[model samples]
Target chain A: MTTNHTNHRTNSSGPPLIQCRRLTKTYKKGDNTITPLQELDLDVPTGDFLALMGPSGSGKTTLLNLIAGIDRPSGGNLIIGGTDISTLSRSKLADWRSVNVGYVFQLYNLVPVLTAYENVELPLLLHSMSAKDRHEKVQTAMQLVGIADRHDHYPRQLSGGQEQRVAIARAIVTDPTIIVGDEPTGDLDQESAQAIMDLMVQLCEDLGKTLIIVTHDAKSAAYAKRTLHLEKGRLIEAAVLAARRAPLVPQEA
Target chain B: MRLLPFAYAVRNLGRSPSRLFLSVAGAAMVVLLILVAGGFVNGMSRALRATGGEHNVILMGAGSEESVERSEIEAGVPGVLAASVAGVRTRAGVAYVSPEVHVMLPVRVGAAARTTTQSSGEQAAAAQGSNTASMSKPKGRQVMMRGVTPTAALVHESVSLTEGRWPVSGADEVLVGRMAATVLGVAEIDVQVGKAVMIDGRPWEVVGRFSAPGTVVEAEVWLPLADLMTATKRETISCVVLTLDPYNEETGEGADFGDIAAFTKTRPDLELVPMTEREYYGKLANFFGPIKIVAWVTAGLIAVGGLFGGLNTMYAAFASRIRELGTLQSIGYRRLAIVWSMIQESTLATAAGGLIACAVGVFMLDGLAVRFSMGAFGLMIDETVIGLGLLTGLALGVVGALPPAIRCLKPTIPVALKAV
Candidate 1:
């Protein structure tokens, strides 16, 4: 079956910011050659908020990592903003990711040694800007996530939800073209997870930033504009759930 | 590539205080070992190098140039050199010539109440025949004994009497070097002025103390030329040490070393070889090359052991931060940048240790006396040795951090992010 995303496309303001044609990823796990993704085609338009859902070993996070430019595709093309980052050199891809992609993690991976404000200012260090400019950008991002008062607190000092807020600030400080999250709310409590999902939705709706998140929680996936499911390294064509009521108690990986 | 903040590297070092301590201690030990080795080698080399006076020459029997102790030259050689060598240095019409006896003999420290020391069992065995055997037998250590006359001071210009008067001929008196205590395997106080030490089984009053700083002669025991000859019961002298004046171009008022060599050559009956004092001691330095190599090898091996310990510590350090490393990479940091930051962190710790080692070396180890076969010399922990130690510490930092950094960074970002 083919992926028909006419109804799933949330923003039609411009061409697709990310496109994957027959993308594949494989690795050797001991004697077994394991493929997590294969020949998958998908398109994510500008300002689109998409959620990828799957059980364990289904490649949802793998897809997110490729889109985040943190991993390379072994086969096919991964074009983001008209550039096939799959072919870029390791160093060039790092440069591209710095300017064009910001990523959040399931565990809210802020550097523990750094304070909240310093963590938020991290991605901005890659840019050639004055310290004053970086400070301003960091402050704005912190305020946007409503955690400006906790700027000096380290990740260990903040709660799970507050850590995620600081992480979101870090992702948005660069004003990148795409933001990807892998199980962003997987480690939070129910209320904290809801709060993190709300902040992420606000990021997409207000800033018009392209967002893709991999989640095992149906409640979290419901917050996205489009949701896709995968099984056995292939996308399930029938599970194109968009802004619909997801099943309660999603299977945990 | 954009670099990580120095604060990140600095702060990481404080994460585990125990690990930080271990790293610092390892570096300190490595650097301290290097300092010790450098001190030993430098002290020995300097002592040998400085013992030779630039304008001084030695007249030894031709077949015994290797060791002055075994050389037997005619007692009249000094007079023959003064009369034949036109460029010989002189003051008040007396030629600068010293007839000397060089011998190594068992010596006893007979000072009262001198008991335990950094004592050697072999020395105690050699001192078994002490006259008052029970309490007075501290130890008998072999010491270089030099017999020199009053004219000997003119030829050896570095020597100066620090206390008491010089030993006159046939007075059964001896002068001790500043490091004579170390050579005799006794405390510094044991060899003080007015004490008597047993040389060749006879008590000789220590009438004076002299120091030729940084030279091998500072370890020798000196007595009058006539006294040493009588005690050893040998008529011939060991060698004649003499000084030559640099010759003038136009007036030719003084002589060169070649003038002395030409005199020795003209008289086949003399059976003597003319060697500059510098050449003799310089050859001694070369003979001790193996000891220097052993010191360096010992230091290197210990450093390698420290490096391995540091490697294990650093590997555990960087390994625990695998996920953090992944997070940094995902935030657009290149792997090389992360490695650079890790090296910075490691180097800062080790450089601190190196600084501590240098301070200790300067304050505690510099000019510390050590006894050896020839005599004794002070450990020379000068600027050069300290510099070598610091460089060693810096190298430890860089070399220690590299493998662990690379290994921790080997995994892909996705794989690393999954690390526990």
Candidate 2:
């Protein structure tokens, strides 16, 4: 069955918000050299919802991490919003990521001792906003994610779906340009997974946030405007070309 | 800049309550040891230094400069020194020259002849005046006893009759120190005023009790010089204690100790060695140097052990939270931010521990009497001691936590996230 993707209008005049040309990441594990992402090229315009799908060990998370600026590329260029993040210093890259990307995890990596409000306020603390402003922004973000009622509850006190909502609230609190998810719904049940995917879609459509999510579930991918598949360490060309021609559908092999 | 919200560091400590308690306990132990060591040295030094006046001089038998108890000078030495030294202080035309005999005399607590214990049970029994029922024979304990003339009061200003009248001269009257009853082997309530003490098989009436606060004299009993000489059958005194006129800094010529030194040199038959009381006590304090060093060494070794224990605990705690730290890093926190956060957590724990240790020290150790070779001294856990304890706790926090924090945060975000 096919799922409908949002036909959000895009500005085709400007350069894409994110661009990767021959981007690569490799590591030496004892005697074997492992390349998680190699020679990859992609363009993600602002406000685009892109789903990354692949099997285990298929470098899906690696590409997501590189795009989020959490991992540096080993070779080639990764230009995000006209800045080559690949050449930035570690500290500079961290500062760049703080304003440019917000990451959501499958397990909801909220500090266990901090309340939902505190977890959502974490990113805002990196900025120089006044306490009143931070409070306003955190409340707005939590309300938008439908977790405002549980803002005082800790992560352990909330259900899986509620915790995921808090995690999303934390992501968008900084008003970052892109929100990257590494299996954002991997741990939730089908209904909760659909709810999280729908919230992510809302974040993109309503806030103009570029959403890139790593997921293996076809239903989770169907919420995106386009779904791209990676095998081994390279993106499959046929699937990308097909996706460019139409809206998102489950294209898993 | 604010690395992480301080609340983040503070609240993170509550995540592992048991581990936090363990680390805080370790830090507290180190702080306590340092505090106790400082108190020991401070109390002992104060007890020795405060016992003597700077204007007073001591005359002991030659070659016995270390201990007045071992010195044997003729009883007429004080008279001759007072007559010869022009700067010898006199109050109301009476020279402040006190000829004293320092000796150990048997202090009888009960009639049973058994040695007394310092145990609370025995002290309680002694304090209750129940000696008649508990004793079948005389129970005696030897305490440091001083044979002093009345002028001893003028020479040693710290001593004062706290409870009853001072003993009259040439009378079979003895005065006990306020601390004498608390001394081990003599927990006797009978040592107080109006009671009779059996010394050398002779009954001496206890006419008074005295206190010399913060001085070693607080721990000694006093009796008339003639009575003690007759009772102990000794014609010699331990030392001649003399108070001199204060030096005139303006004239540069008054009450010189050089006059007493010259008098000792002329009277070769007396075999007298003279020194200022301050110098004598200074030497005595130096003699206890090894004890002070031992206290310091013990505390230092214990502190090292505590530091390692704290470090190992932080290592394990940080190991389990590597992924969390990585997540923080991925959320745009710099590595230095995480390090600062870790330091803040450790310091907060140790600071809490320091407060606990201060409470323990104040309630448990302050003013608690300890018996040393010279006499007994109460631990002085004053504000200075508490400040030192807190400083030590903070130091332990930084020294014990920073290395492990740096090591744990060394890995990159990707590598750290992959950790379990």
Candidate 3:
């Protein structure tokens, strides 16, 4: 099938919050060179809920990671807000990530030893703030995610949906510029996945958060305003703005 | 920049009970070996240092300076040295000089027989008791036997009779040091005052018990010089010990080694070499240098084994948390911070173990007797040894955990998030 692989830019009314121009990521496995992402160009507008979707071995998660500043691009520029993050040193990037990005994982990768409240408060420790300020932020994040009652419970003591809620709380606690989730609902059930997706949607609509998530589930991607499909490290298709809140099908590229 | 909470690192240790146990136990074993090695060397060195007094000199045969037991000089050298050396201390018209005979001999307490003895001694043992042979297998512990006169107390002031009185000459009586039984491989009750100890195929009464505190002479058996000379059939004495007046530089009222050396040169016919007691024992201590090296090497190798054990445990621990570590990094915690947290966890476990080892050293290993050719000395588990033990344990934790922590944190966030 002939498909259009486009270098996407913002279609929103305002300037984009993230700009990726000719982004490339390559690594060596034994003797062969593997490029998980190659010359990928994308723009995410502010207050946008974007979802990245693709098959296994596609670069959806790779793109999410690159935007989150946890991984660097081998070629091209990644400018988030204003600074070119790809040029920043590793430690500097970490400082930027603390202030700018919050990442949620598929399995709700909360430290097993810490309580739900401590897990939510983890990122805030990187910032210099009074105990009262950190406590208030953590309380607000947990209450917003509706997991304030389970703050004292550890990961093992909580159910899967509750753990995911705590993870979402942790993601939003820092009030970062961008929140990235790599298969955030991949390990949850249908009801829990729907609840998590609803919470994420509220984060964008009410809090004006810019969220980029990588998911393989069509139902999960339906919550986002737009969804981009990647194939072999390239963008093959992108859904329209404010895509229907149902199982999404790709629009004609 | 930002660090994980101390509570976080501490709580991580309780995740796997078996791994924690392995880490703590391995650290304890390594630390214990280090403490033992340190104590042994410290005790040996202290014993040698205490055996020599700087103000005393030993005049032995010129060629036999290496060992007092091998040295032989004319019996009249003590009287001549006392008169010729102006620096020899004297009080009440008697010089602080002692002509002595030194020998290594077997000591049989009660019915027990010494392992190193002639066939006649064995026959004597057979006549004493049928169980003598069984008791004789001390493995092999021999003691230094020193022959001394009444004037010996004047120069060797550190020796003091703790129980009973000095041995009466010509009566086959002997004065035993407090540690004599330990060096003779016998029960303490067997060598108490009024008991009999067979030496040189004759029964000698243990009339007195003496102690020289930390010195090596505390392990010797002292008898009358005349009796020892007649029993060994020796025509010459082993050496003459002279206590010189303490050298005072400001007043020039005391004498130094040069004064003693001049006296030796005036009469080369005696073929005597003058050595400070400190130098003599220092040479003996140097003779055991290789043994100390072997001790440290063995400790180091075992410490390596403990390190590997620690590495294996930590690797397994961090392996299970690979995804969690990735999550932390994604939370904007730097790699160095994560590594630091891991080291904190490891050091806590090892530090606990180090404390246990140090406690054991203080309460049990301290002052434990160790036998050597010179005599027996107690293992000195002093502050320095304990300090070294604690430091080594900390180093073990830091060095052992670094590789595993770095390896676990190697996977990129995308790859790590996918780890099952």
Candidate 4:
């Protein structure tokens, strides 16, 4: 699944799915103003698996949020899927994101009261999909993440790994073009982290979907096709990583 | 967008069950207090208004209703005026006018004596002995007895015989309302069938027991005017009640009692002041106006406190869920929708509180009698009290919810997102 996403990114012609030129975000605290993201330039090509790595306060999450249209850049351009998201109104950007992007948070923000299936079906509520289609899509996403049997289990009832899988299902349930994860495996144990990362990479490669993961873990960064390092609100390096030790090619291929 | 805010709000509340319970309980207490206070005021007003004596207009001797106890006129004035009044409604050509005398007297039961020597020592001796025995024989029980003719029943529509028939002409029979009978610890047969009660040490045969339309009349005892006058032995007349001639529509028909009083002032033969039963009760209500005002003021102040408590709960609830609200906003829910959802939450909470209070109030307090003098009228909780209580709940929901909702929606997305 990972190889197919790398193949699509290597093949797409016109531009990257996410393009940021001189992006800056500033926060005012009392009398002092702090710049979180300063003149950062990055491009995330379609169907690419990119991992952003940085220390705390390095604006790694800010950059990912800007690309996902979850937060606005104080200055400069952010174009995601051909739309200048930085210039779009909050409401308009929200609409754009629901259709084009899905978010997976570190804490697995799965409304604890709702079952795995319902949590995965949350984002689809904004869409015009029929209930049957939504149900099928959610079921397929759950099955793909291998948590189909746990669909009725609440997040509190599931293991950290299973919950993250449900979170991943939710992220990709809409079949969004880009899936953004802010430390998706940060809260999981080693085995759970590996299982979640494996499922995520499988979904990316198998589904031809772009995945951006923000993480400080080198082992987690090792799974991505591209690793972008951020320092003090600016991109320090952008490079393609060596493929996972096990080649992602299907058994038939 | 539609589900996110509510989802988060509900989830956030669920996350901290203790806080949610505390807030809901606090809100419920406030709502309950408002409901009870509102019910109390309503009950008092109904009780006072109920004393209108069923549309019977009392004509005082050239003074006010408050002054009626001190005022007097010729005993034969009612009969003479009944014959001459221009608009008196008649049944079989007999004017439905009856002269009545009202006086408050101290009544005692069992061994309690009202004599000055016995009363002075009674309090000290009773206090030294058992309190229950002293309480059982209440000292100087103030009972308002009305001296009335048989026609008094016609004038006061609420009067009804539950036992023996109305006093036979010239018979020494007395009737009492149900509440009065209950308070006096005498059954309908004791007051109605053929028993007798003491009036100034004279035993008057009880002829009938009656129930009035409202609670105030229930506290009164009725006796034949001549017998009551004979028992007391010094009465001229307290007041005269007369109906106007029904045929003289132009001159006296539909004449307001106040206007009739003014017209009567011009005549030298009679010095009378007239007022409708309602107006008379209104004047009586004036006596308790200050007490009512104080009650309302206290309730209003407490209500404001309760409102603040409710507002605080809602504000805290909304504030803690800013992240969820931002999530909704980012998912395309309008600011108005978020605001509306918060309002709905508040309304729902307060409405639940109101319903609890109402159920508690109805089950425990409805038809509960609270007897206090509002001048001549005696005010209890009734249907009106319940209606006001429910209305108060609705008003609390509206007034307490709107302000916080507006504040919640005013913050921009970036600010709201950062709130968490």
Candidate 5:
């Protein structure tokens, strides 16, 4: 599917922003080895809105988590913005993720005890910015997400949509280069899900953030500029699924 | 790097109020136990040391250095010492040598008074050998009886009459020390001036009350020496106390410690040992030193137990917050930073408990008297004790929380985030 806002304001003239070359992730569970993502190759350019669609156990979230740097790939070179993050130390990866990647969870994983403002301010606390500067950034981020008035409300006090908006505010407060979402609107109502997708579209088109969303909903995927389908930890052509789902042409008698 | 906000750690305590309360209460108990134990040692040591005076000398049986109460000397020893020691101080032309008899007579409160106070476990054990005063109930609490001569007033200047007059010379009158009731674990009204105490099956009226603050003497019941001797049919006395002449270096006529030591050495027939009052009390203090150490050790062991309890609670508490910790780590907080925040939360809980413990100890435990074999002493919760309590609380917090905090945060971000 093609996005309506194809023209972005921020600079997009660059090589692929994220490159995954044979990215693999394997783990052991009680002597049973499990490979979630095996030898996967992918590239996401700057200012691109990409959606990943797959069935259960298809490793969509695993790929998203690896891209977000919360999980490391096994036996692969995963490079983002000219840095081979697979080779970086754990602490160095965390630092890199803090500055370059903003992540949103399906459940809108806001700390229940923290107010919306404090939740939005969490990412900027990693920087050496002054309090005033952090406050301004948090305010701007909350304002951009159109939830500034609900800043003091805790996650439990806010609706699911409002909480997800706070989570998005927290994501962009640091002004990260890439935003990764795992089932971002999975738990929301249809209207709220559409609203969140529209917000993501706006973030990519206006602010030039590279967005990679993992979802199973076709309506959600329609909002992205390009969509990829995966099955059994390996990427497959979307045209194949479209062709299968397309109605058979009938001969006129 | 930036630290985790203080507000986060503090406000998170409200998440589990019962858990927070239990942690705080446990910490407070440990701190209070330490304070009470330390105060006991301090008060007992001070009481023992304060019993001795610099200018007084004690003469007891040669072999009974451990207990003056058990020491026995000839009745004429005081007179012989008075005549032999020339430099002894004379007041109003009379020598200041006092003959004293220390007897541990089993005493019981009056029948009317017995119903008002309950005997402690120790006193009940002591009352086992005695007969019931009324045949309807057990006898009142048992106590130690001290028999002293009139000259004792001059030798121990700390003794001051607080209520009523001193016991008559040859009568069955007795005077109770202010802390005697506490030592006996009886009601204060049971040992007041108007009360009567039965000693050796004979009733002696409480003619007066005396106080010797901060000394073991405050735990004794003082009676006439002649009366106690006649009643118990004892011809021998316990010890002889004497006031020394102020030492004059130039004239060399006043009583010198060297002269007293020589006197004890020359008199082989007397079979007497001479020691300064300070030296006697110093021996008593040393005798109780092991007890002080035992109190501290018990408190330390309990504190260690409290530490493990705190650690377990923290483990569960921090384990439940694994996802929150993962969130912090994913937001770029280092493992050590999260560990520090956990420590801050534990420390804040313990420190709050410490403050409460200190206030409770000072108000409830301080000046509370405890009785032992030798005498009774009040608890001393001074600055040192308070400081010790705080240090214990802080240590409990740090040592207890560190391991759990580190263990909870040990997992990688994805693994921790996966925790429910």
Candidate 6:
């Protein structure tokens, strides 16, 4: 058995922070099978802004979850940050995801009882951080998201855009390398949606973080540096574009 | 992971204020019922046991251990045999032995309206007449009258003279218990200071009024042993109280009362029985045992029903929040954490109910007296009953919360995420 040093070098050179090689996932529905990912191959380089666009049953969210290690693929390998996530135990996978990926949902799933600062401090509680450090990190995250003034407000007391900004602060408070969003603006009006998308863009480009977003809105899709279009569980189009393709219209903002 | 979910649980409960109020009210009612029933039973038992004085030793006829009131022994036999018994303590070289007769008779107040036609003023006049006439007649309204020797008071420490003094030796004087005096409307008669009472058409002077340590004696009338015998026309004593030296000391040989009663059979002329005072009252109180049993059984059944009602309320409340639980799961709380939060929420609600029940019991039921056997014992809300209520509340909370938490935790991420 000869040691392959060249193969090792190649693996080290192309070490995508998140790599999905021919990943597939299927669902069973009353004796019929629905394939959500069909041999899907994708590589998310470190600090890249990628958008996923497709119709309702087009597997965009499924691919995002695979990259975020929220779900396992039935076939092929999922490598995120030099570790095979598919091979990790469920608990270990959760720990890995907590450190590596932060999620922002469309509905802004804030615990309704907690104040904005407390909600943002949730992820850090899983670590060994002191209370003072947690408080500082939460304050800084809220300040960065421009919702520091509303730190004591509950989710129900905040507006749509403000709540979404709180959710963004929660996702980034732990300072994870990658952020995954599932239709982050799906429930918002044009103005709130543009504001949320703009926040995501700034988090990725200015903060030097990777972002993977799943959306159907072309306006939201246009904010990313790359857009992958999926159809019938397969990637049909992949395009690389400028990070700021165009400024959102003032009226929408 | 922290108490975060507890806050959420509390807020969710408060979200629908009416439902929360109804659930808490139902639990409180059940707890209150449990506490009241427990207090009643405890009061009854205390009343019964309180009748036995610490220094008293009851002596019954040998063949009839069950009924001290029905037992008969020759009056001379007690004084003679009591001197021979070992462990018989003496205060001044005289053993504290008292042969007594116990009898029950119906008693009514003299002030009970004599006729329907009498006006309140005329009724008062009639009541005064009846009270005066009662002094001359031997028996007016009847009551349970105990016939005791002067030494009886020495054996039973509970007997205390509230006015006047104990009857003189060989006198036809009687001492009425304080409660009997109140019930008979003769509290101011200077009962033991020679006021007269009638028994069997023979007037007997009251020499004193006494209060016993407990409620039982408060319902009795005490008279001289000879007068009670003549009034009732009974020749035999019902029972005897014998004082014994401490078991550890040696005043004489330790004679078993049971063996002495057996020894008397050889004479063929006398019958005797022997037992401790505690054992005698233990039998006398048997009638109340079944009542207590039935009370506990009924309370337990009602408690079971309340538990199920509580469980159903929690299940329904949690069922409506499945989407919220799923959201929590997606937000990275472990299933165990969610379960713990649910349990904490249910416990908080049930504990609130328990506390309310205790408050209601203390406010509405404490010190409320109920008459039984012509005596009254105040309802006692003890610590043990309160402890049982709290334990039941915690059990209800845990049992109620488990099913819904398990249901919430079972589904996969996709299914949970899709719950909305």
Error of 2 at B163 (Å): 1.1
Cα lDDT tens digits for candidate 4, B346-415: 6656666667766776677555444454212222344665566566666766677678767776776545
Model 4's DockQ score: 0.26
Query: Candidate 2 has which clashing residue pairs, if any?
Result: B111-B137, B111-B138, B112-B137, B113-B137, B113-B138, B113-B139
Q: Tens digit of lDDT per residue, candidate 1, span B317-367?
A: 999999999999999999999999999999988888898888889999889
Q: For candidate 1, give the docking quality class from DockQ.
A: medium
In angstroms and one decimal each, the interface RMSD of every candidate reads 0.6, 1.1, 0.8, 3.4, 1.3, 2.8
**Which consecutive 10 residues in model 5 chain B have the weakest lDDT in total?**
B113-122
Best by lDDT: 1
**What would the per-residue lDDT of candidate 4 be over residues A16-132, giving only the tens digit for each residue?**
888777788998889999887887666778778999987798888888877877778899888877889888876777788778887887877666667898888877887887889
Question: What tens digits encode model 3's per-residue C-alpha lDDT throughout B206-233?
Answer: 9999988878898999999999998889
Every candidate's lDDT = 0.89, 0.84, 0.87, 0.70, 0.85, 0.73
- Which is the leading candidate under DockQ? 3
Per-model B-chain TM-score: 0.93, 0.88, 0.92, 0.73, 0.90, 0.74
Kindly report, for each predicted structure in the order presented, the TM-score of its chain A compared with the true chain A. 0.90, 0.90, 0.91, 0.88, 0.91, 0.88
DockQ of each: 0.75, 0.58, 0.77, 0.26, 0.54, 0.20
The CAPRI category of model 5 is medium
Give the DockQ ranking, best first. Answer: 3, 1, 2, 5, 4, 6
In candidate 1, list every pair of residues with a backbone clash. B87-B255
> For residues A154-239, could you state the per-residue lDDT of candidate 6 as single tens digits?
99999989999998998898888999999999999999999889888988887889999999999999999778777667776322
- Candidate 5, residues A56-104, lDDT tens digits: the string is 8888888888899888898687889999999988889878988998888
| Model 6 RMSD, rounded to 1 decimal | 7.9
TM-score of every candidate: 0.93, 0.89, 0.92, 0.81, 0.89, 0.78
Clashes of 4: 10
